[model samples]
Target: MNLIKYTSIAAIFVSTSLIIAKILTYHFSHSIAILSSLVDSSLDLLTSLINCVAIFYAAKPKDEDHKFGHSAIEDIASFIQAMIIFISGILIIYQASMNIVNHKVITFEKVSMYTMLLSLFMTICLVLLQKYTISKTKSLVISADCLHYKTDVLMNIGIIASLFILKFTHFYAIDSIVAICIAVYIIYSAFELGKSAFNNLMGREISRQEQDEIIAIIQAENRIKGFHDFKTRRSGQMSFIQIHIEMKGDLTLFTAHEICEEIEQKITEKIPNCEIIIHKDPC
Candidate 1:
């Protein structure tokens, strides 16, 4: 299995474990902070489930039905995940505000601390796994998944801090405030993730550096005079590039075909997991 599949599986496992821990903690203390953690973990579980299915479909090779490929399904999945996160954030904020207004006090029990510590440790491990998967695949979906886990790490830390404050200072209001802050942060991240996936679905262009590098490689070849109509886009980890190359009118058809083949090979080397389509035009 690929890194993405492995990461998704690990995410699902960790999220499930966290949810159980959060439930146990919440039952023990009835703390809003702990409940907030439970909410985050529930979203994580849902997202991971969706991601597993998305990755499975995204990995399928191009078929007759999907001429362009099924890779972009991952982006769609990302957008869905973002929407879920946004909804979860809004709900969290509303709950936190209600708790604050009602003067709900959270009594921190020892079990709550233990659960929080375990959650923190699990989050750290998941973060490391995400980092490794991203390094191996350079997949946007996996990167977004990593970002979610990283955000979870921060949220867990904030919850732990709130617990500590409530324990020592006896300021229960701080717990609701921390929950509200976490909700806001989650909403912001959801917006950013959704924007990125939406742009990709809208056929966003590739990076300037990649474009420049492709142009340079093509121009360096002696057989190619100049090129135009260069275009590039991405689907999951795959990049597709199309260009029209100017060539000598006198060149034979076989020679031109060879040149195009060579150019395609060079480009494939420069950018792994890329498809290059060269169109020949007489200069």
Candidate 2:
């Protein structure tokens, strides 16, 4: 959790620096490609700030009013991030189209390229840290932020490529074309992120593979006759499972409970950060 918080802070700092650098780059170059990168960095700052707040809120303990915990805050944060990214993409598309019509000529191509290189280096470093944090924490919020940075790395590369083409070809329209392409990719990314958030908000079930694994674990218990009413859902880092197992009618209640405990332990070993409720039924 501390690592997640630190990574989120690092993202904010990196985005802030990128926005400052890109602002200068765009001012000097007047390139729509640079402008697109600038817009993305600006939004990255806002998204990182939002992620920080959402993660802090989501870390709160479950209360009487919110028994499920505040994990849904992470989903809400992702939804808002999607909306923000979508709007930025549209705005960039409009700006790029206008540049195309006006026949905008980009200057300071070398400066913009250098700035993009810097941005790329910083973004890659942040993404590496985020990857490590996600591996340790399995945080959805951090994963979403990492996705944004990954896209920024690609955007930086695209901007550099556009600047290179313009430097040699003297074809000004390429800047606007690259910007538009970047905008389209940004919108596509927003859609993918939004869909995942929406599904999680709707209490989507665990994956089929995980469900099969759980089923197999249950079936391995010879004392249990059968099981039914198996249901699962995920919230933040937690998986909630509810299932009823059938057992021999002659078994004592204590024995039945012990069997259930054994099964629960096995499942827990298989899947960490999961809460299980196993109700025993007499066959």
Candidate 3:
């Protein structure tokens, strides 16, 4: 399997395990904090499943139906994931508020506490693995998964701290307040992720650094007079770049073809998995 598939499978496994663990934890202690954790894990499970399917579709080669390739599905999948997260966050805020208003005390027994901590640790490991995969493959879907787990890490820490404080101070209000904070954080992250996905879907330009690198490489070739009408877009691991390269009018067709080939080669070397097209224009 490709890196995207592999990373997504790992995410599904980890998220499934977390959901099961959270359910067990909630059953044992009936802690509000644990219930909150359960809600987040359940959503994670759903999104992970969706992500797996999306990755499969996204990995498919470009067909007549999708001439630009199926890679943009990754961004769509990420947007869906973000929507799920946003909904979960709203639910958490509502539940936490109700619990606080009702003055419900959260009973955190040893089992629940240990389970939550264990789940947190496992999530941390998953986050690390996802980060490594993203660094290598730069898959946005996998990166989204990593962001989810990173937020979970913060939520787990907050929940643990709130539980302990409630246990000692007998102040149940803190539990709900912490939950609200977590919900807000989740919503904020969801907005950011969703916005990023939307930008990608809307054909955002490549990074400035990469654009500069491409320009530098092209300018370094003495045969090329100048360039214009540069354009770029990305779909998953693949990047498409097009530019008009001005050349001397005296250059033969064969020579211009050679220069285009050299430019393509240098660009491919500089940016792996990139597709470059040069429109040669005589000066």
Clashes of 2: 0
Q: What residue runs in model 1 are displaced by over 4 Å at the alpha carbon?
A: 252-255
Candidate 1: give the clashing pairs: none
Per-residue lDDT value at 90 in model 3: 94
Residue range 1-283, candidate 3, lDDT tens digits: 3876887788788878878887887887777677778877887887888888888987687789888778777778778878988988899899889997888876657777787788889899889888888888776677777877898998899888877886788887887788788788878988997888787788888788889999999999998989999999876556789999999999999999999999899898778767788999999
* Alpha-carbon RMSD to native, per candidate: 2.0, 1.7, 2.1
Off by over 4 Å in 2: none
Give Cα distance to truth, residue 54, candidate 3, Å.
2.0
Error of 1 at 13 (Å): 0.5
Q: What is the Å distance of residue 76 in model 3 from its true position?
A: 1.8
> Per model, how many backbone clashes are there?
0, 0, 0
Alpha-carbon local distance difference test for all models: 0.86, 0.87, 0.82
Worst 10 residues of 2 by lDDT: 102-111
Per-prediction TM-score: 0.91, 0.93, 0.90
